[model samples]
Target: MSKSKNESNGGITAYSVKTKTKNVPMIDPVIDIKSGRYIATGKDSEGNKMAAILGKAKAEEHIKNGDAKKGTGWD
Candidate 1:
């Protein structure tokens, strides 16, 4: 990205992120496996439900350790 004039002068400017914020659903999603649907359940430190594959246990542990919340809030 090209630097703005203010940036060149050491002045910081706020810019919006280029991606939309995605809200993870609270309910554990049911994935359609060949045998049946698998339901996932877990929460982040802030209590935000995290049911995505590949880090549920570790993320939940982090949440309990301080990286997340409890109940139903977002981090």
Candidate 2:
């Protein structure tokens, strides 16, 4: 199963089933104070999506493409 939660700002958190063998977190993006929206190439300290200075339309496109998951954080 998966879940999500709302952040302080107008951003969201998401979690989904891991891959075939590993229980690793899925490649999902996260909205931040700066940098804006971005996607995950499966690397980084937080492993969160890379931050991008994209517009609303473009950001939505990422979400639609499943590059970014929408909703809340896990409990």
Candidate 3:
């Protein structure tokens, strides 16, 4: 998985933020508009692109069920 350099240490990940602690992954993910896979949302710590094997199924399911929509109002 990739982590942005700006990602705060011990801070909440985009995945967790999106799911609002509802059985979500622990990384920032980008949904591929074509394949619907969960790829890394930002650059890795080393500034390279990344994808997480751990979050794919869950993210896909979330997207399919429209759980990816709406805000948790966390911001």
Q: What local distance difference test score does each model get?
A: 0.32, 0.37, 0.37
Per-residue lDDT over 5-74 for candidate 2, one digit per residue giving the tens place of the 0 to 100 score: 3221233323322322222333445423233433333322354433333345644655665555543321
Stretches of candidate 3 exceeding 4 Å from the true structure: 1-28, 36-41, 53-57, 60-75
The TM-scores, one per candidate, come to 0.23, 0.32, 0.27
Model 1 global lDDT (CA atoms, 0 to 1): 0.32
lDDT of 1 by residue, 3-66 (tens): 4321222221222122222333323222222223222344333454444331344334434444
Q: Considering TM-score, where higher is better, how would the candidates rank from best to worst?
A: 2, 3, 1
Candidate 3 residue lDDT tens string, 1-75: 765432234222343333233222334334443244344343333344433332545544544554343222211
User: Which candidate do you rate higher for TM-score, 1 or 3?
Assistant: 3
Off by over 4 Å in 1: 1-54, 73-75
Better of 2 and 3 by TM-score: 2
Window of ten residues with lowest summed lDDT in model 3: 66-75
Clashing pairs in 3: none
lDDT of 2 at 6: 22
Using TM-score as the measure, which candidate wins?
Answer: 2
